[model samples]
Target: MAEFMTETEQSSPVVPHPGTTGERRGRAGGSDAGPYDGQEAAALLERTRTLVDPELRAALESLPGSLRRIALYHFGWQHADGTPARDNAGKAIRPALVLAAAAALGGPTAQAAAVRAAVAIELVHNFTLLHDDVMDRDTSRRHRPTVWSVFGDADAILAGDALQALALRLLAEDPHPASAPAAARLADCVVELCAGQHADTDMERRAPDEVTLDEVLAMSEAKTGALLGCACALGALYAGAGDEDVAALDGFGRQAGLAFQLIDDVIGIWGDPRHTGKPAGADLASRKKSLPVVAALSSGAPAAAELAALYAEPYVSGDAEGVVRTALAVERAGGRDWAQTEAADRMARAVQELSRAVPAPEAADGLLALAEFVTRRTG
Candidate 1:
């Protein structure tokens, strides 16, 4: 259910710890002194939207009428009343990773050839988002109401199913040698993602004390890391890379995805609603067993008991004080520190994995920048 938004209306920034990814990047060079930074990532994402949006739109346009309308609405291309709307689809990060991985390995030619695969990956991603919103009961995404909230659950689910089918169909109809393999890989990833989602929903029903930090971490990897890894692997396939290199790219993306999740979990608790498009302490209010929460629950801190007691009681509507206490308990129990430290470690591993495939710093810059942009998000 974690979605990466590139732009946010920031209230306050999340300052990185001394040895964290942001801090290291600063020491290596400031934005003016280095090519890999938020600006580079933003440019890459903008370029990716330009390349992939037309194909994505064409694919959606080919859908049958009712489904097309729902799909268009979900993607922010149209309103519920069928009026044209401004674009709010997303930042196109996953597709950008596809193109960047291809470019890193095999240059512009491979990047150009991987456009179809990029579209397919993006399709699969949006499909997940649609279903996740329904399952998570999230009211908003990308600063707007979610599809299920506006169009109802049945329409939202059917639209998501249609999108998944289109993703595979795009790959199946492609003439590239990598198409079949990419399709197979993507299908496997979908299965893993489903399993992860199941685990997440199941964990929500369990007592907080009954859920382990290890279990939550595993679920997060399956739900978030699997698709990101698949995206990079698809790009490598399109580039005709060797198995080891493809696997390395997959590892890189997976680590980065995990890092992104850790930061997202942190934001879910402490993030500003104006920037995140969600109410403050939404995760705590729902008692979601996020990474930080689980870590806090398992920390054996004195505040853990207080947190568990608070979580044991259902959150009453309008009880803002309860949410505040829960958040403070989590913070005092060391959840915040563990999550941030874990995120930095994951980013480091991501960089190491990226180097295994794209040894040249210049070649790896785009992927690194994207990874940094995601993990560094404060909202």
Candidate 2:
């Protein structure tokens, strides 16, 4: 793993945005900017919304009355100000990846059915998040109360169930012959997702000393990698891509997903609260066995000892500060450095696989650019 990190680390450099000016600010400054600043990432997100909203609406219309209303609310169809406006519901990064992959495979952006497949993938992603927040006891998401917090847990659970069903239904309803197989792949991905969640919960129950980096990586791949792979595979099939293209895209998605998770782990520890929509060291407070923390423990450093001590205590009032301190310890011990290098490696592999999958230079360039943006974005 260390060799892998060393080999891939230099493939991509994180260039500072021209707008940043290298200005350093206090913790709150990072997220004070609006979610949709006039940046390339925001522009891509806008394009995704235009492509996905119609299909999302159509899918919601097909749902039962209660489910449809809940889904609409979950997607921010109703405004935070209690008015009717389609706000920025979610980032739609995965759907953008799907659409880019399809385009790279010579599919038309106007293919309604392919767009529907993209919408299905986004819905499934959010569905898992809705349920995950409930299971993880997370109260906040996207800087607002989570669905499970706003509605009750039972309602959120039902919403998740309905969304999963809607994902398959959309796939099945597609006139394309490849849709069926794509739907099956999605189902398999969900199974893997559940398996990963179970593993995560089991790890949380075990002694901190018992965890290993390999186990953490396995769980991360299952939880995050599988759905990303499904997104790419679905896109390829919808584009009428060959089996080889689909397989290559699948590999790309897996590597990209791992990179995404690693960056997420980094943010979970040190992310600016405003941009991440969470407090710094949020994962530590939740006692999550994230990749960096696992790496620190496995490396057996002073930071690991501090983390072990922190983990040994029962939940108590005023422990959040202690958790943050322990998280800082992990960062000081080079765990964060290791994880960032790993993220860069995974991203390099994703780019390499995407290049192999699509020989056309223009199409391949777009996909590669999107991959780079995903890992490099600050918020």
Candidate 3:
């Protein structure tokens, strides 16, 4: 299991290159170091995306012109004004997970059959993102104006709906044996995602003190973990993995997803905007009930009381100092420390869950590396 040293470790950061085990260990600081082998991850990502990009483009082309334009801009396939561009699309993590899971279960040769599942998962992810930007009223994503901010909310909403339909259509139309269950699983995951988003929205409407750690964690799992789990499970199904193996893969993804969410919250507070492509202290400025914020408020410490006082009032969006203060308050209340520890523990647990499905170390290596990759970034 690859879990890196915490940012607080007070050591120089070293990004390990692809090389011998000794070289990897040296850069990672120990023989047992769990670091992301970037070359391996990059190659897998590029190859998988190369395989799926054309089909994904064709899927977008099938949409009506208005929607297609919106989708293309959103995907970074075109400039906001529809001029051609090569801006990077979103990180194709979910789809890569689909192929990695399939390779783990059925070997690399069998992964081609699972491409539809990968594409379906990516479409569903973007659907949630479009609706989420509208719901959150977020003006920016990946260094550009969010879809709803550029276009109207209704257009963004309709585009999200269309994308959701496209996901199901891909699954339903695929002739593979796993298509039916994959579609069902994707639909079920969407329901959970909506439920999580609802919980999140509901919490924002209430007093910050009224939100509990358990509630926030559950919401994180639903909103993020469900889709990731479904992505892995669909891959397993395509690989002809049995129910138990499929369930284990889902568990692996779910735990890793939770860890990813935790780190994302941390990044929201302390991340450099230049690196993260979001406003500095964005979550604190929005006063959204991110995991660490809720955890600090619920910690029952004096600092928790101080943090609650800040949250009892709304966060003004442009008040950089106030957001910084709120972040410090959360840290003082042990929320940041707790989240960091929990995220590390969860990443390790994810590897254990992965082992239950693919017992072979060779088969499990890529999945393990990807799981670590989730926690390796400041962004």
Candidate 4:
């Protein structure tokens, strides 16, 4: 639900260093040194796999016929080639965040249950991706044909439905006494996600002049921020964290989610096709009302006027060059600068929330590292 920056924007020539390395380090410096590199993300994924693979596998096994097989393929649990390759599926970042939050709350007796909760969060995330591809008519994902593109729209929809059900079922299986509350919170998050999606889709249908920055932010908070907050709160709940800690973690998650979405919007515009796996100016081609474009339009720049004019044209009539021109208009109008500043501010707020949380040393370190990694990631 959270929008990322356009990948093509990553290659934009506006190369002003947004923040000094020292400032960045200082922001993350309070915590003890922990793995912040991509490898650390990989390690976290491995840990999560060790904890949830059995349960995920059991859930998959219980599904009927081709539906089960398709879900496995969607998760990268099986290969398109049908060979047994255990590749890095997803980064599993959300689960890692959940675990770190729980661990920070002082070793919960139900660490495994928390891990299961993390898996549910990740599955729900992927489930959205599946449906998103269909709705967006995307052709590829994770360097492969999308389920809709390969198996047809019907199958993709069915798989997404099943995955959503699986996530709820997993949440229901939490062995801790706190599982019920956590499950309820997760369900509420799903409702928020739907609300966000409705806002986003509604925006798409409206005239560009009708959209507002406030609406965009609200949409992002619901679509992207809600689930992330749920992940953090669910972790704390599983660990029997006090209300204060849970609230702090929830604040941290909300800020982190906003930061993540801002960075993603930048990537959507400027990221390299090789790294991001999306075409350059893909958002512009789709005429997406992303944060940067929205900011530029709201700022009323000359280029913003041009962008609005282009967006007013029918998609069938819009050319690739038009898309590229419109994206550049956003950058020239200072949307990029505005987004970068907002991202830094959100990251700072997240750190402040983390500081207030008062997690244990190791868990705090990991959580801080994770936040830094999310804000700083290039791909």
Candidate 5:
């Protein structure tokens, strides 16, 4: 079977595919490969939303009219017209990570206590999404018009800013000792995310050849990995874990986040529009210097020149053939293979870090399944 399977297929993300880089590296080592139920990850995510929604909804409700409307719309809880809509918040991956990490280390008690922290982390994630959509000028999210597209850019930006404030406030009002540190860590992550976003915009202006693999990797870590790491670490903190174990959990989340980004980039170029809710070749149309694109440019293969030429010229609207050729160039230049292999390797490392904290495979199943699901989904 192909690694890039259909988005609708039932995939066993818990186990690395045979002969893949993760399998060769023994993803979680010998004892870490127990009976992992992929369905548990989904259940955990659903449960996380159940536990965190009320608090999250209350926080959003606290916002004044304009900001509240935008925030609520952005979160999928309300329609553009401010009427109630079916709950459509995203997958709740980050919050699930927080809760799962807590459960892995300290069992159900810790998981219950960490609900507020999970909500805070979710708020931060959505805050970034709102801002990112505006900065990227993306027109859609969750199959609906983006905040910036529906409401003006200024409103979207203000809503994003409000979300960040709300996240910190949730932590501040909590009496839990972990709340203080979690707040500080989340604040730091916001700074790093902003810096990473700046670097991303800056990279887009530069020549493709000028951006290095290391630079893009660093930016990915800052923008995506940092928050994930903080999520896991906050969970550990709430569990009363020592610093070392907390750091290990953070490392696990960071590595898994990088793997998730790798797959996400691949999907950006080739994912099905039916599932991704975006036009095909959207990344190519935007001339995004995604990890694969950068890797391909760095390769010395003849296709590198072809890809460079394709990237050098701005993509004209409706240039389907051009997008196909550019995607082919990236593949022939070894970008696709490299990114997949790299993602598996990152997963292997993530499992290693996870094992350091939660040695038992059964205990770590939730985190592992969530990590795999994020990395395995083609859309």
Candidate 6:
């Protein structure tokens, strides 16, 4: 059994993923076998896209025409010229977790029962991204121009709002017995996401000293963890799971989401831009208070103090050397090591949480594979 850990303990030397200036990065140990081995993960993702994309596309059609076009285009369903495009879109991880959880608890036959839950979660996930792209002023996502960058901010925001409403309406209109509680859970997730985003933006505007590690963790759990938890919980609900099972699945996804966020913060700093679909050091360049940055600031090392000095002023957008040095300073301050350790620990706990809901290892292979995909990344 994994112990519940609330503090970070650390060690490591890491490199960026391959094709980023020809430097190859790997995890600390040899590869482990599972359904989620990268190749299989891609296949699982494709299978999920085939399963969920039709229903997801159908939801877009229920929107107002102009808003629907913008949303569809944002989803990589259409090109800027309003023609069909075959590009892959969002990662589809959330919806996959929902179906995987349902399958784990109630077997493959429960997949159809979980469709409404899957669609609702996926819609809410995209809605968050649409709004996030606008707020973050991100120019690109999935290597395509962001919705706000392409369609203008107001229209993008309107489309996002429409999607959120449509997600709830899907549940409310569905005849499934679990729809009402699932809808309530999704609504709660949206509220928490908003609160988390508010906390994040609020932190950015204040001094680095003003934020606490606990505060950042709380904000992260709300921002990234809440929806993931809802996605998993909705599946159990659809499977007609007991309260204990639902709660366990929720905990599994929540802890894994937190672990995923920790790795994401590391990627935001050191990950290859080619694989991540964003500029390297984008977070540092923006001076955003991401978890690693916050953790570094909270550390008491002299390097931490220096990093705090760097954050004392606004980051110049084009200062590559500054970004590189900031990343180095963060690592020296033990920020990177702490995040990696925390992520691994959380992932183990997440698996433990899964065992509570589905005791048989074979039953949880799919969900375990998904959880491993979160932490055991090469890029």
Best by TM-score: 1
Q: lDDT tens digits, residues 35-154, model 4?
A: 344345456657866776776678777889788767877877776555565753566667777887887775655465587788788878878888878877778676667788878899
How much lDDT does each candidate structure score? 0.85, 0.72, 0.78, 0.72, 0.82, 0.78
Among residues 3 or more apart in sequence or in different chains, the pairs in candidate 6 whose N, CA or C atoms overlap within 3 Å are none
> TM-score, each model?
0.91, 0.83, 0.88, 0.84, 0.91, 0.88
Q: Give candidate 3 regions above 4 Å deviation.
A: 1-33, 316-321
Q: Locate the minimum summed-lDDT window of 10 residues in model 6.
A: 1-10
Per-residue lDDT value at 248 in model 1: 94
User: How many residue pairs clash (N, CA or C atoms closer than 3 angstroms) in each of the candidate models, in the order given?
Assistant: 0, 0, 1, 24, 0, 0
Worst 10 residues of 5 by lDDT: 1-10
Q: Which ten residues in a row have the lowest lDDT in candidate 4?
A: 8-17
After best superposition, candidate 1 residue 240: deviation in angstroms?
0.8
Model 4, residue 242: what's the lDDT? 78
lDDT per residue (tens digit) for residues 1-379 in model 6: 0111111111122221111212223345334333344554456567778888888999998787899899889889999778999955666888888998888888877877787789889888888889988887878677689889988999889999999998999999999888998998889889999998888778777888899999989998888888788889998998889999999999989988898788778877887665554467888887877888889989998899989988887887689999999999999998888887777666666777788888887888777766666555433
> 3 or 5: which has the higher lDDT?
5
Residue-level error in angstroms, candidate 5, position 370: 0.7
Q: Model 2 segments beyond 4 Å from truth? A: 1-41, 79-86, 109-113, 314-325, 377-379
Model 5 ranges with Cα > 4 A deviation:
1-37, 274-279
| Clashing pairs for predicted structure model 2, backbone only | none
User: Order of candidates by lDDT, top first?
Assistant: 1, 5, 3, 6, 4, 2
lDDT per residue, candidate 1, 1-379, as tens digits? 5788555542221223222434432111122323344778889999999999999999999999999999998888999888999998988888999999999999999999899999999999989999999998989888789999998999999999999999999999999998998899999999989999999999988888889999999999999998888899999989999899999999988988998898789878987776766577999998888999999989999999999999999999999999999999999999988887787677778777788898887888888888777776543
Q: What's the CA error at residue 222 for candidate 1, in Å? A: 1.0
What would the per-residue lDDT of candidate 5 be over residues 1-379, giving only the tens digit for each residue?
Answer: 0012223322324335322325632123223433344576678878888899999999999999989999999989999999999998877888989999999999999999999999999898888888898888878777679999999999989999999999999999999988998888889889988898888888878988899999999999888888888899999999989999999999999998888788778777876676654466888888989999999999999999999999999999889999999999999999888887787778888888888898887888888877866665533
Tens-place lDDT per residue, model 3, 1-379, is 0112222221111222222211221112223334554557667778878978998989999999999999998888888788877956666778888999999999866588999889999899999989999998878676668899988999899999999999999999999988998898899999999998898788889888777899989988998888778888988999999999999999988988888788778777776665555466888877778888888888888899888888778777577788888889999998887777667666666777787898887887777666666555543
